[model samples]
Target chain A: MKKHNFNSGPSILPQEVLQQASEAVLDFNGIGLSILEIGHRTSWFVEVINEARALVKELMQLGEDYDVLFLQGGATTQFMQVPLNLLDKDAAAAYCVNGIWGDKAVKEAKIFGNVNVVSSTKDKNHSYIQKDFSVPSDNVYLHYTSNNTVEGTQWHTTPNTNLPLIADMSSDIFSRPVDFSKHSLIYAGAQKNAGAAGVTIVVVKKDILGKTNRNISPIMDYRKHIEADALLNTPPVFAVYVSILTLRWIKKEGGLVEMEKRAKERADLLYSTLDSLPVFAPIVAKKDRSLMNATFTTHNKELENLFLEECKQQGMIGVKGHRSVGGLRVSMYNAMPISSVQALVDLMIDFNRRNG
Target chain B: MKKHNFNSGPSILPQEVLQQASEAVLDFNGIGLSILEIGHRTSWFVEVINEARALVKELMQLGEDYDVLFLQGGATTQFMQVPLNLLDKDAAAAYCVNGIWGDKAVKEAKIFGNVNVVSSTKDKNHSYIQKDFSVPSDNVYLHYTSNNTVEGTQWHTTPNTNLPLIADMSSDIFSRPVDFSKHSLIYAGAQKNAGAAGVTIVVVKKDILGKTNRNISPIMDYRKHIEADALLNTPPVFAVYVSILTLRWIKKEGGLVEMEKRAKERADLLYSTLDSLPVFAPIVAKKDRSLMNATFTTHNKELENLFLEECKQQGMIGVKGHRSVGGLRVSMYNAMPISSVQALVDLMIDFNRRNG
Candidate 1:
C-alpha cells in the first residue's frame, strides 16, 4: 500500500527525487566513488553546489544582488546568527511573535540585543496572525516567520517596513512566489520544502552586512560567509547534493506558480472536508490558515483517537498533532503529491461518515 | 576497475555500509517512508540516534559521567564552543599548536578568553610535534589535535595536564584506543573516521559544563545540548543516521583493535615504499607520522606531476597533495583497505623503475 506521509519538516519528498538521491549515494554521476566519500572541494561537488545555489536564485526570481549560502545547523542556528551579524549593541530588531517559532526567534535575538515585539497573537494561543501591527522605525531589522508550522498560520502579506527585513521562511519558502526585493535576508531550513535535514539555505542582500558594532564569530559572520561563497569550511556535502536534486525537481514541476496552484488545491480540498463535518473544526482563522500545514481538531478525545487510528490503519501517517496544540496536523509540503491529500481527504470523509 | 579512494576527510567508507545507507534512503527499515522523509522526532529515528550515541560510549569505554552528543556545524563549531562553555573571563586556556587544525582551535579559543600557547611546532613548519611543553595548572583546559590531517602527524602521547583536557580528534577517533579518562572532552568531524560531513561527534565530561561565566548561546552551549539529548533542535537527521550505520559497521569489523592493526599495516606499507624510493621523501618525522594521512614529496615537480597522472590513469584517486603543502598526500583512514595501500606501493615501484 502506498503510504500518505504528512511529517512536518523532514516531511514528504517527491518519489523521483528520492530515487535520484539514492542513486547518487551509490555512485554519483558514475564516478565510482559514492557521494558519501567524495570531498566537498572536489570539482563535481563544487558544480553540484553551484547549480543548487543558482536554482534558488532562479526560482525566487532574485537577481545577482542576493547571495545564496548553504549552511549547517538548520533554522534554529539562524535564529541566533541573524541577530549576531545584523544587530548592534545599542540597536533593536523588530519581531512579530505570531506562533511558537516566532517566539523562539525573539528569545534567541534577545541574547544578542534588544528585541521589540511589534505584534503577537499569544493571547489567543497563536490561532491567528497579528496583521495590524506596526514595524517600528527605530528597529535595525524586522524579523518574521512566513508560516508557523505548529499553529498553521501564515502571513498572507509581508510587513511593510523601511528597515531591512529578515524572514525565517523555514516551512513555506518555495511553496509560493514572494516579493524578494523587500527582504534583506531570507533563510529556510531545507528539510521542509527544499530537500533534506542538514543544510539551511540563506538568501541575503550583501549590502546589509558589516554594520554591527558587535564582533560576530567568524563561523556566524555573514560577511565572511558571503566572501567565501559558503565554502569557508567543509559543508554538508550529501545534504547539499540532495537539495540540488530537489531544486531540479522544483524547476521541472513549473516552479512556485505551479506550486501555489497545487498548494491551494490540496489545502482547499482538505479544508472543505473539515468545514463540511461538524466533528472537525479548523484551528486557525480562515484568513490566516496555512496552505502547507492544515491543523484541525475534534474536541471530543475519544472520537479524535478513533479518527487517528482509522487513518493509521488506512496507510496515513504523521497526522498526530503537536503536543502543544493537541488535535491533528496534515503537512502538505511542496513535494507532497496531491494524491496523498486526496487519500487523506477520503480517510477524513470516511471517518466523519461512520461517526457524524 | 575498482578505484582506490584516498581523499583526506570525507574519504572512504565500507562497501556494505554504503549499500545499507542507500537502501535506507529508499525505504527505511521496512517503514514505508524513505529515511529522507522521516521526522527527527519519530520513534525509528529516536532509536537510531540513541544507539549511535550509546555505541560511541561503548567503544570509548565511557561511563555515565560522560555525555555523548551528535551535533551539526562540524568540529569548527566546537573550536569556539569549547571555549564558550568552559572558559571564564579571568582564567586562561592552554593550547599546543602542532598544525593547521590545532592553530585554528587556538584562534577560535582566543575569541572567548585568554589563551596560552604553551608550545608550538610552527618554526619547523609543523613537520613534527612539539612534545616538551608544561601544562599551566591555573589554565581552564588544555586543547590539542590528536591527528593533524594536513601535516600527517599524530601525537603518540597526550599532553600531561592536571587541568581539564580537550582534544580535536577529527582524524583519529576510532582508529586507535585512547585514554578517555584523561580528556575532559573529545570531538571529531564525522567526515573522516566516523561517517559523513554534516554531523560531529562530541564526548564531554558532564562536570566541566556550567562553569563558564559568559552567557553562551543556547545552540553553542554544551549544557543545553546535554539536557536535550542533542535534540535541542532538529539535528542533522540524515548525517546522524549515516553515522549510526558506520558505527554499526565498525563494531561488526572487530571494533577499534582491528582498526588500529589495519591502520598500522596500511601506513607502514606506504611509508616503507616512500623510504625505498630514492625519488620520494617523507615529510613528517618518524615518531610523529600519522597512520591516517601519509604526506611525502619529490623534489622534481615534473616527476611528481607524471606520477600523479599515471596514478589517475590506473584508477587511483585523491593522491594530490594539498595546495599549501605542494607535494603528495595519501590519506588512509580506517575505511581505506590495505589492498589500496599495496596498489599505491606497486605503482610507486613501477614509476621508479621507469623514471630512475
Candidate 2:
C-alpha cells in the first residue's frame, strides 16, 4: 500500500534525504565507521555541521551578521533559552499567545522577566492570528510563533515590531520564504520541514547577545555557543547530518521560492475542496489558515472518527487533528507532494458525498 | 576491509543495532513510514521511548521508583539542569573536580547555587581520582564524573557521601554494574554506551525532585519530563528508537555483568601490552585507568603521529586523542570486540619491537 504521511511532524522528509540518511547510519560517506560511531569533532563531522550552518545562512539570505547554530532539546528548549539569553531582568519582553506553543513560550519568559502579552488569540480558541499587536518601547524582544500547528493558523506576515523580533518557525519553516533578515532570531525544530526530530536550528543576529547582565550558564548563553561556532560541546551529530541533507534538498528544489509555490498549491487544493464540501469545514479563519496544517471538522462531530477510519483504510496517516482541537488536520509540509493533497481531497469529497 | 573502531563516543554500537536502525529509517516495522516521518505522539514512537526507558531501569537493576527520561541535549545540558532542579539558591552542591567535564558541571552549578569542591585531582593534572575527601552534610548533592574521557580516569567505587549522590556517567555507563540504586540521580549521553548522539538518558529517584522549590523551568525540571513520560515535548524519535535496539542488544548479550567482564578483558589486554612495551606509556594513574578509554603517549613524543599513522593504515578509526589531552586514546566501549583489542595490542607489540 502506498501510504501518504500527513502527520504534523517528525513529519515528512524528501525521499532522497531519507535514502542518504539511512545509508549514513550504516556507513557514513563510505567511511568504514557508521555515523553513529564517529566522533563529533572529527573533520568529516565538522564539515557536516559547518556545511549545515552555511546552508541555513544561504537559504535564509542572511549575512555574516547572523550566525546559525544547531542546538538540541528542540524548539521547546528555545522557549526558555530565548528569554534566558535575550530578556533582561526587570525589563519586559513582548509575547503573542496564539496557541499552546506560544502560551508555553510566554510562561517561560515570565520566569526570566516580566512578559508583556502584546497580542493573544486564545480567547477565540486561537482560531485567528492577531494583526494589531503593539510592542512597547524598551521591551527586549517581541516573540510569536509564526505557525501554530494545533490551531492550524499561520501569520503570513511578520508582525510589525521594532523590538528585535523572534519567531518559532518549528512547524512551517522552509515551507515558504519570509523576510528572514528582519528577525533578530529565528528557530525551527528539524522535525517539520527540515529533517529529523533531534536538532533545532537557531539563527541569531550576532550583536543582540551579552547585553543581559545576568550570569548565564555558558551552554544556555548564545554568545558562548556562537563564540565556539556551535562546537562548544558535542552536538546531536546524526540529527544535524539529516538536516544538512534536507536543506540540500530544499536548495536543490529551487529554494524556498519553489517550496512556497508547492505549499500554496497544496493548501489551495485542500482548502478549495473543503470549501465546496458542505459536510466539511475548516475550523480556522479562512485568511489565517495554515499552509502547513489544514484543520477541519465535519458538520456532524460524530462523523470525525468515521472519516478518520476511512483515511486509515486508504493508507492516509496522521490526518487526525490534535486532541486539544478536536477536528481533522491534514499536515502538508514542504516535502509533501501535491499528489498527497489530491489524495486527501479525494477522500474528503468521497466522505462528504456519502455522509451528506 | 575489517576496520577496528576505537573512537570515543558516538562510538561503536552493535552491528545488528546499526542494521536495524538503518532499515527503520527507510521503512519502520513494515509500516510504510520512515521512523523519521512518524509523529512523536503516535503509538509507534511512544512505545519506542517507553521501551528504551524500561530497558535502562531493568539493566540498571533499579525498581520503578527511579524514573528514566530520554531527553535531548547531551549530558552537558544536565550540567545546568541538575543544579537548576536540585540545588536551591542558598543550598550548596558538593563536586569533585577530576576532569574538564566535572569542571564544567561545577561552573554550571555555581550559576544556581554555592558549590563546594569536595575533592580535586586537577592539582596533579587529573592523573588520578581523588579519594579521602568528605562532602558536607548540608550539600544538596555530591556530584562527580564517573569516567573522565579526556584525562582517562575512572572511579571504580562510588564515593561515600551522606548528601544526595549524583553521577554523570556519560562515558562509562552500562560498561559495568554498580550499586545504582544508591545514587539519587544518574545521567549519561546516549552516544557512549547506550545508543546514538541525540538523546541523553536521565535516571532519577522520583522523591529527589520537586524539593528545590526554586521556580524551575518546566522543561529543565526532571519532574515535568518524568510526569509526561519523556514526551513533554518532541523527543529525538529516531535516537530513542536506536537506543531501544541498542538496549535490547545489551540484554541479549547477558546485560551489564557480561559487559563488565568484557570491559575488563579488553582493558587488561590493552594495559598489559602497554605496560610490557618499553616504547609506550599509559599516562594516567594505573590504578585509576578507565576501562572505556585507554589514553597513552609514546616514550619518544616524535613517534606518536607515526603510531597513529600505523593505526590509520590498519583501518583503525578515530585513534587520535583530544587536543586538550594530547595523547592517543583507544576507546573500547561495550560493542568493541576483543579481536579489535587484540589487533591493537598486536600492532603495539610489533611497533615496540621495531622501535625498541
Candidate 3:
C-alpha cells in the first residue's frame, strides 16, 4: 500500500529532495566528507547557502532591497523576534488572530510591545478568516498569518494594509504566487513547504529593521543576521542543504504557478467529495477554505475513530486532526500528490458506505 | 587519497553514525515516510529525544535534578540566554575571557547583567588559560569556555569557584570526563562532539532556574523547554536524530572514558611531533594545550603557505588557521580517529625535512 503522509508541519517533501539530502549525509558533493562534517565557512557550504538564498528571492520575485536569511529556531521564535526588532516600546502593532498560531503570535508580541487586536475569529472557533478589521492609527505594522494550518482557513489574498506588513507564512508559503514585495517581513519554518524542520527562512526588507529603540540580542536581531549574510553563527547546515534541494525542486517543477495548480486540484478534489457525501461535513467557511489543509468530520461523531482506523489500515500517516481540534484533517502541501488526497477521499466514501 | 578532515566546530562525525543519519533521511526506522516529514509530536521522535536526553545525563553521571534539552540555534544563542535566565539586571556574574568565544560570551552577558571579569588571558594574546583570579562573593555564577577552538587553549582543570558554574563546552564536550555536577548549566553546539550543526545540547540543573526576575521569552527560557521536553516548537528533527545516532555510537564505543583515551593518544602524538621538530612550533602553554585541538605554526613565516600547500596535496582539509590570528589549528574532536592525526603528523614531518 502506498503511504500518504499528511503531517501538518515538518510535512511532506519531494522524493528527489530526500534522496539528495540522504546522499549528502554520506558524502557531500563527493568531497570525501559528510555534509554534517563540513565547515560552515567552507566554499562547499557557502555555495549551498548562497544558492538557497538566491533561489528564495528568484522564486518569490523579490528585488534587491529584500534579504533572505536561514536562521535556527522555528517560526515560533520569530513570533517574538518580529516585534523585538520591528516594534518599539511605545509603538503598537496591529494583529489579526484567526487561529492557534495567530493567537500565540499575539501573546508573544504583547510581551515585546503594545499589540492591538484589530480582528479575531476566536469567537467563531476560528473557522473563518476575519476580514473586517480597522488598523490602529499609530500601528508599526499589521501582522497576520497568511494561512492557518490548525484552523483550516487561509487569506485568499494579501490583507489590505499600507503599514509595513509582517506575515507568518509558516504553513502555506510557496503554495501560491503572491505579491511578496508588499510585505516588509515574511517568516516561515522550513518544515512545511519550504524544506525541513530546524531552520527558518526570513525574507525581509532591509530598511524595516534597526528602527526599534530597544536592545535586542544579536541572535534575535534581524539586522545582525542580515549583516553577517546569515552566517552570524554556525547555522543549521543539513537543514539549509535540504532547503536548497527543496527550492531546486520547486523551481524545476515550475515554481509557485505550478504549485498553486497542484494545491487547488488536491483541495478541490477532497472538498468536492466531502460535499457530495451526505454523511460527511467539511469544517471552515467555504469562501475561506485552505488549499493546503482541508478539515472535515462525519455527522456521527462516534464514527471518527472507525474512520481513522480505516485510514491507518490503508497506510495513511498523520491524518488525525490536531489534539486541540478533534476531527480529521487532510493536509495537502505543495509536495502532496493529488493521488494522496484522492486516496483519503476514497477511504472517506467507503467509510460512509459502511457506517452511514 | 583518503581525506583527513580537521574542520573546527562543524567538524568530523563517526562514519557509522553518518551512515545511519543518511539512512534515516530516506526512510526513518523502515517507516514509509522520510524522517524529514515526520511530525515532532509523534511517538517516534519523542522516543528519540527522550533517549538522547537520557544519554546526556548517563554519560555525564548526573542525576534527576539535571534536565537535558536539544535546542535550536548554536552555542551563540546560549551566550545571552545564560544571563537572561540566570543573571538579574541588578546582579553580577563572574566571567573568564580566554579567547574569541569567551570575549563574545562576556559581551552578550554584560547586556543582561554586570559582568565581573574575574580572569582574562587577552594580554598574552590568549595563548594560555589565566588561572590566577578571585571570584567575587556577590557574583551569581562563574562562567568560562571549557575549550577555545580558535585560540587552541583549554582549561586543564575546571575553574575553582563556589558560584554556580556555567561552561560552554562546545568544541571539547564529550572528549573528557568532567565532574559534571560542578556546573549548573552546560551548553554545546552539537556540530562538534555531540552530533550535527543544527541542534544544541543543554544539560541544565533544574533548581538553578527561576532565580532571575526577568520575563524571558518562552523559546529562550530553559525552564519552558524543560517543561515542554525539548519540543517547545518544531525542533530540528533531523539534527536531533543525528545526535541520537552519534550518542549511540559513543555509548557503544565505551562512552566518555574511551573518548578521553583516544583524545589523549591523538593529542600526545601530534604535540610530541611538533616538539621534536624545531621548524614546527606549538602555541599555548605546555600544560594548557587542548586535548581536542592542537594549534601551531612553522617558525619561518614564509613557509606557512608552503606547509599548507603540501598539507592540501596530502588530502588534509581545514588545517588552515583561524582567519583572525594566523597559524594552523588541528581540531581532534571525539569523532576524529587517531589515524587522521597520524596522517597530519606524517605530512608535517615531510614538510619539515624539505624546508629544513
Winning candidate number (lDDT): 2
Residue-level lDDT tens digits of model 3 in B44-119: 8999999999998989999999999999889999998899899999999999999999889998988898999889
- Backbone clashes (count) for model 2: 0
- Candidate 1 regions exceeding 4 Å error are none
DockQ, model 3, C-alpha based? 0.80
Which TM-score value belongs to model 3?
0.99
What share of the reference contacts is kept in model 3? 0.83
Model 2 residue A89 CA deviation in Å: 1.6
List fnat, each candidate.
0.72, 0.82, 0.83
> In candidate 2, which residue ranges exceed 4 Å CA deviation?
none
Candidate 1 fnat reads: 0.72
Pick the winner on lDDT between candidates 2 and 3: 2
lDDT of 2 by residue, B1-356 (tens): 64798888889999999999999999999999899999989899888887888889999999978999999889989999999999999999899999999999999999999999989998888989987897778888899999998888999999887878999999999998989998999999999899999999999998888887699888888888988878999999989998899899999999999999999999999999998899988889989999999888897667998999899999988777878878889899999999999999999999989887
User: Where does candidate 3 stray beyond 4 Å?
Assistant: none
- Residue pairs clashing in model 1 are none
Residue B139 C-alpha lDDT in model 2? 85
